[model samples]
Each structure stands twice: as C-alpha cells, then as structure tokens.
Target: MQVLFITGQNQYGVVSHFLDGMREDLESVGVRTDSLSVESEQHIHRDLPQLLPLQEYDQLISFNGMGLHLEQAELSVPQYLKQRPVWVFCVDHPMHILKRIIGLNVILLCVDEEHVSFAQLCGFNARLFPHAIGKQQLANTSMMPLEDKSNEVVFPVSYMDSGSHRQALTPYWSQIGHWVEQSRSVTRFMQFIGVLPIGNRPASLTLNEQILRLCVTVDSYLRAKQREACLHFFAQQNVNLTVIGRNSHCYQSIAPTHQYLNAMDFTDLQQKIAAARYVVHNSPGFERGLHERVIYPLALGTLVLTFETPYVNQTFPQVCLDAKQSSGQISDKEYQQRRKQAHQQIEQQHCWHHQLRKLFTSPTTSPDSNGRTR
Candidate 1:
C-alpha cells in the first residue's frame, strides 16, 4: 500500500525530519510513500485538486494536523479528503487543534494515551501511537563507554513563560489552578474542564469548543510552570548543565550559571545529546506518553533524567525521577547496563520502522461509526 504525507512549514522545524524518517522507514518495509507540501490553508483550496489524486495513495498521513484544516478549506477539499482515509499524527495535546478537527473524517494518531481519551470524548476516532526514534538519531552517535562521555547534562527544551496566559485567564485562574494541582492525570484534567462553566464564551463557539480553548491555555501554563520548577531544581544541584533550544536565555533567572545555547537543528541537537552523560527532559503535559526528546537521547546511548510520568515510570523506571526525588548518581557499570537496555527497548518497539508497519497493518474503523460528520 502507498501513503501520502501531508506536510507544511512549522515553527519547530522538526516535522520535516520526522516525515523524512517515516518515509524512509516505511519504504524499507516495502510500503510506497510520497509527500504533498501544502504551504497554507489557501494552498489546500487552490492546489489539492490538481495535485492530490486520491486513487494513487491508499492513505494520507499528516503531522501535527498540517494540511487537514477541513473546516476552513473549500467544500471540494473536504470532499476529496473524505474519499480516502486521513490520519493526523498529533505531536501535541489534541486540545490545541480540536476545533479544526471536529466533524472531519480523519483518524487521530495521538502520541499520548491521554490524548486518545480526550479525542474520543469529543466523539473522534483516536489511537495511541507514541513518537519513534529516527535512523538519523541512531546514526549520529555511537554508544561510548560511560566513563568516556562527558559529565555534563544537556536539556534540549524551548522556554516559554506562561505569566501572560495566566493573567489573561485571571477570572478562571482559581478554578484552572485547582484543576491543575488536584488532577492526577491528563484524563482527570479533561474531566475537570468538561464541567467548567465559561459564561463569557463567544457566540460563535460551542460550549465544548470554548472549554477546549481553555484547556489548551491551562495546559500550556502548567507545562511552563513544571519546566521552570525542574530547571530551578537542577540549578540547586550545581551540576554542569547545558540548556539548548529556542529562548534559552529566558532561563537566566532560573538557571543563571548553567550554559545556554540557542536552538540548533535536529541533527546537531542529537550530536549534543550523544556527547552528554545525561539528558534532562520535562514532559509537556504528557502523563502517559514518551516524547521524542526522551526517546532520542536513550536511542543515542545517553541516560535520560525526566519527570516521573506514568509511562516512563512503568517503561523506564530506572530513569524516572520527580523533583522531590533525587536523580541520584549511578555507577558506570550500572549506567552502561541501563543504556544498553534502553537502546534495546527503543530498537525493538520505538523505532519508526516498527511503528509504521504496525500502523499500516492495523484495522481502521469506518468514519460513520467513529464520530459525527459536518
């Protein structure tokens, strides 16, 4: 079977790399693949008819919901999309783009299990599909002896302060904050938001749509808070730390002494991760999913020090640690063994070749049975 990847420009610049890796992996497994670049929503209206001949491709896959704005596109565009299976590989929380996806004939391949539940709640078809390590990540670095790797810790993260968002949602801060603090998991947070009353919602949006917008705002705020707290905790430890990614300088107040480098491309970031002894990661509101940030380092033979999430605690208990719990030192022998095990696990289950094969072979539900249509 052949698949067409619907791609577009994104701020993070990692989507293209992900598509490239997925295409290569799929091809290796004998699944033909191609790509369609839709620069914007207008392109979907103007270019899709002549460019996208659905018969040639058995399926269409989009990263982060790119080129799937059926709500805004011309009727013909959505009509074409409905003719075949369309799958969106959501790399972020589904709440962020739920409005655009509602009433569309598309399946959501979510990176987190909680995301799946959230989509299902909205009457959409969603699957739990975690991010996979690319071949480039593995090829960029070899497993060095634990003692030979530098003692430095590398954190590849983008810093965003949520102060403004909190201020903007001042009236709902108390309720939102309580939900964030009291909710044990993402699913619980969703349940809390579902009951929240937003009287000031615009007439153009339905209650559920307004609630989803609030959820996105609150989720971003919580992630910023968590990242700041993690950075402060690391600062107190006085270990050699390097922060890489966009807006690294914004972390000055939290981690003044730590080295900061501007964001680099994926390959360069992988090289930095490979040279480090440990990679520190903060989940962006994922309670039951592994981010590529957490997976790539492990695949490159570097130990990951991340917040204690359910998925991580269960899958990589050896590397899971919360702010209250110390990361604690590991002996070289133990470190090497952990790295070996992590690498083996990634190769077996978290590689693109394995994930794509499973996805393509799996049975899909009919759109009529999955959810409502526009």
Candidate 2:
C-alpha cells in the first residue's frame, strides 16, 4: 500500500513530529508513505496536486480537513486523482460547507463524535478517529529518574487575544434574545428544555450557523476561563509552576507565583517532559474531547496532573488529580505506577498503528472494495 498525507502546519510544530512516527510505523509494515504540509488554506486549493503527484499513490489521507480546503478539493482533486480514496481526518467540528462536500469517494474521520453524527445526519460516511500518541515519542525520550526530575509542574498555555474577542463579543451578548437573560437558575432550567441563548452570534450567521458558532464560542470561553482559574488556584498555593508558551499574559492573573517559559520544539519539549516529575494539563473545559496533551505526557511515562473531567475520569481514573491538591500529594511510587499504566494503555489502544489497523480492517465499505479507508 502507498499513502499520501496532507496535514496543517499546527501551532508549535507538534503535528510534524507526530507524522514522523506515522511514516516510520507504516514503512515498518511494508507500506510506503509520503506527506505534504499545508501552510495556508490557499496552498491547499492551488498548490496541493502539483506538489503531491497522486499518480503513484493508492490513497490520500488528510489530517485536519479545516485546513485542507475540502470544498475546493472536492471540486479540483477528483479531476486529477479520480477514484483514488480520499480520507479526511477531521480534528474539529465541521462547521462549514465541507460537511456538504463529503461524497462516496470522500470519507470523514473525526476526533469528535458530534462531528461524526453531523456528517452521518448529512448522509455521508464518517467514523470516530480520536487523537493518539506517536510511538516515536517513547523512542526519543530519555526518562529521568523520579528523584532527579524537576519538582516544578509545567503547563503549555494557549495564546488568546482576549481584548479583541471581548470587543467583538460584547454587543452580540447584549443583543441575545431577552428570554435568554433570565436568572442563572432560570437559564439553566431553560437549557433543559432546549432554550439556550445564542451568545454573541455574528450578524452574517443563519440560525443554524449562529447556533454552531455559539456552541464553539461557549466552549472556547469556558476553556479559557477554566485554564485561568486552574492557574490561579495553583499559584495561590505557592506551588512551583511554570507556564510555557508564546504569551504569558493570557494567564497573567497568576503571574506573581508562576514562572513563564517560551514554547520549545516538540523534540526538545519531549526531553523536558521526560525529565519533569509532573506536567499540568488544564481540561479543555466541560465534556469536550481529549487533547494531545494527555497522551503526549503518558507516551513518555511522565506523570500528568490535569483537571478532572468526565473523559479523563473515565479514561485515566488512576492518574486523575483534584485541582485543589498540591503536586506532592501523590507519592513517587504511586506516580510511577500511574505513569506505567498510562504508557501501556496508550501504546496498546491509542497509538497511530492501532488506529490505522482499524481503519484498514473494518468490514464496513472501503474505497474500491479494497477494504482500506486510506
């Protein structure tokens, strides 16, 4: 089998590192693989086919359909790569015309079940393909002894332009249908009956589009707020915490007690993670699906201290930590046990090879009846 992968230039360059493992794993199984990095949406629609000669490739697997310009690809790619399997691994919800573009030749693999349901509702083939840890990470890490590891807990912060977002959102918040502005308890009651407010919906959005935007915005705000609160909670206890990312002011409320560090390349960051006693991960807020943060630490056998949510609670009950507690609460032996369990589970069930096997072997219909989703 031969495969061509198209992926976005993700923030901080972690996607590139993950794909390296994928290439190695596929090659080890006697399958040839190649990849293309889409730097911008423009590159996807115009330069993709020219850069990636699909003639020799049996399959085209794309990661993050949002970046692939799927609508454009739907129109152009078929002209050149006719009948070739085109699999889009969607990491985010399909909110655009891309949902309407998935046809018999195009298969949707989504990280979020909500996306799968949406695609299926639209009468398109979709499957749940959650994020996974790359095996290469384990190979590259040189784990430090528990005693020698840093006591300081490190967190990678997501950058946000709060001022601009707030300015844009304020008016829309006020314009929400008055029925939504009831008391907090009443609002909750209304939500039970499916009467939630369309918070900060843009003027151009239709009702369905605004509702989708509202859901995404609400989740984004909840995550931003939860992250801030988590940082503040730790900082107040005078815990030795380090925040690593491009912007520190994003969580500036915890500035006095927290130290800031610039985000490093994935290779360098893995070394730091392996040497750290514990890496702190803030929940992506509420019931949102897992982020790469959880699996990345576990792959390297580093203890992760994250906010307890339903997904984490169900997935890694042994490794879950209460946000109120200090890092020292867990004994070194207990930490080691959790780390080992996490590593084993992720390697067995959530690694790239594990997922790819399911993708190819599923009895469900495959491209060309070859039993491969590509």
Candidate 3:
C-alpha cells in the first residue's frame, strides 16, 4: 500500500519521533510509506511532502491533522473528507467533541482499548494502536551503560521563548525549592540529567522558499513557551542538574539552585541516569500533562516522579509511578527497588524499537485476529 503520513515537523517533542518511525517500519516491511509535514525537508525526516495536489496521490494519512492549512495547502476539512482515501488519527487525550460535531468517518490510531471504546461511543471509527517507539535511533545512540546506583535525579526542559522578556516559572520554583530543602527522600535523586540543548542551526531556505517556509503557528509557539515554564519551575531544587545537549534559553538564562553540569557524550548520559537517586520530570499543567522526560527516565531504569495527569495513565501506566500519589517518601532501598522494577518493564515492553515494529504493522489478515478488517 502507498501511504502518505503527514505531521508537523518541529522537533518540539515525541510526535516527530513516532511518526518518522512509523514510515521507516512500513518501508522495511515492504509497504510504500511517505512521511511529510511542514518540516519535511529537515535531516530528521526520511520522507518528504510536495506542492502537488494530494488528490492525485494513492493514499493520504494525516498525523492528527498535519496537512490541513488555511491557504498554503488550500485543503479544508470538508475537501479533505470528501476525497478521503484512508484517514487515520493518532491522538491520546480524552474524547474530543469534534468527532461528534464534525461527523468524521476516519479511523483513529488510538492509544488503548479504552480509548477505542470511548471513541466509538462518541460516534467515530477508532482502533487501538498501542504506544510504540522506532528502532533507527537505537543504532544511532551511544547507548550509555548503567552507573553505580547513587542518589541523583534527571530534570529535562522542553523548548523556551527567546523573544519574551519575563521569566515564566516563578510560582512553581518556590515549591521546588521547598521540596529540595525538606525532602531527604530523594537523597540519591539529588543528581539530575537536564535537557538536551538545541544546537539551533536554522535550516537554509531560498528567497521564494523563505517566503514559502512555514513558521511555527502562534498557538504552537505558545505551547512551547508554556513547556519552558514547566522546566524553569524545577530550577531551584536541591539536585545537581546535568544538561544533556545544548538546552533552550530559559534554562541557560537562569542561575540554577542546584549545580549545573554537561555531558561529555551520549554514553555518559546512561551513566548519569543509572547513578541518580530518582528522576524528577517537568510536566506543564495543561489540558493533558504530557512530558517525555518521564517516559525515557523509566525506560532507562530510573525511578520517575511526574505531575499527575491523564496522559501518563493513557501512555505509560506500566513503567511510571504516579508522582501525585508519591510523597517523595521512599527510602534509598525502596528507590532502588523501583529502579529495578522499571528496567524490567523496559526490557519486557517499553524498548523503543520493539514498539515501533508493533505500531507500523497494519492490522493483519490473520484469522486469529477474528477476520476483522479496517
């Protein structure tokens, strides 16, 4: 099958990672897969989108709702549905009113069985496509080996606003300060692995192309800024925050309460996590509490504590501890046990490559699948 997958290009978080992996898996399995979005030309992207009318294409798949543009693509929801080939949406939040309001007939790349059932009740065709990861990055990573279990923590930041003048994390920073001062619970959690800093080499564009280039929409940029506030909130905590790569300006701008450090290389990251007491993930208080810092920390066998939100329950129930319920009260021995349990989960079900294979393989024709067809 010829499949065209469209999603936004900005590497703000995990969407690019998952969507790109899907295309790679489909191609390896001998299906023709094309991955496209506003940032399709970037190095991270394997497939590309073009200006030609998608109506001429064999199949079109929107990643959530990637290709729908007001003027540039000249494709509206009505036109999109009327010419629909195979429309599949990948969304993890609670049921959206749009499924009922717009009256769409598209299938969904749902997160779980509950999500599928809920979508069905709301009057849409949905299917469970469990959360997964891609294998390509597995080969690319330096693959850090575990360190001697120490009381360290990892605090990762998302993107930030360079244009804005005000510091965003003021309210939450005081709380983190209080926790750091009062909580001996995470003595080992004191060592933090902060975010990967952006190397920020803007992609080149020609004059006509410059005008044609799609900048991040205002709403998307605001969302990124909001994530910055989430990260900054943890700045004054007692832990030692070691940054992975060149992080955003919000982190770079502020003086850290905890000492700051940088990685010598990617392998060093593994050593840092293995040694840390626990992982303190920064999650924005938003409609859905989504943060990647939580998931990767667990997969690496670190004990994770994050903001309580619906997304965590939907995306990563088996691997993570509910941060809201956790008082940060566990002993060092208890912490180690949590780490041991977490790594076991990763080995069994959360390896990125393993999940990628599961996601891209379309619903099989096997009779064991009860002869169900999409």
- Clashes, model 3: 19
Off by over 4 Å in 3: 39-59, 69-105, 110-122, 128-131, 139-142, 147-152, 157-278, 282-291, 299-303, 307-344, 351-374
- Deviating ranges (above 4 Å) for candidate 1: 40-52, 69-77, 135-141, 145-148, 174-177, 180-187, 195-207, 319-328, 363-374
Give the alpha carbon lDDT tens digit for every residue of 1-374 in model 2: 78778776676678776677777777778888877666776666565555445556766787755333433543345543355556777765554435434444567777655556556655557777777765665566555678888776778776554345445446566654342233222223224224332344322322365665554454454455566666777776777677877776456554567887777777677777777767887754224456666778777777777764556556776765645553557788888888778877877777778777776655454556322443
lDDT of each: 0.72, 0.62, 0.46
Error of 2 at 205 (Å): 11
Report the C-alpha displacement of residue 36, candidate 3, in angstroms. Answer: 2.0
Put down candidate 3 lDDT per residue, 42-157, tens digits, no spaces.
Answer: 52134333433555444566666455442333434346555553455555332332332234435555655544544454445665555544444333333223445665556544
Which numbered prediction scores highest in lDDT against the true structure?
Answer: 1
Put down candidate 1 lDDT per residue, 1-374, tens digits, no spaces: 77788777655567766887888788877878877667776765664665435556677787767766544323333655657547888888877776656777778989888778767756677887888865545555488666678888898888878687677668886767787777554455656665422245323423466676676666777777777777887887776579997988888877798888999988778778888988887785687887887887888888887754657767777654443475548788888888888887887777777667666674543343233222
Candidate 1: pairs in clash: none
RMSD of 3: 13.3
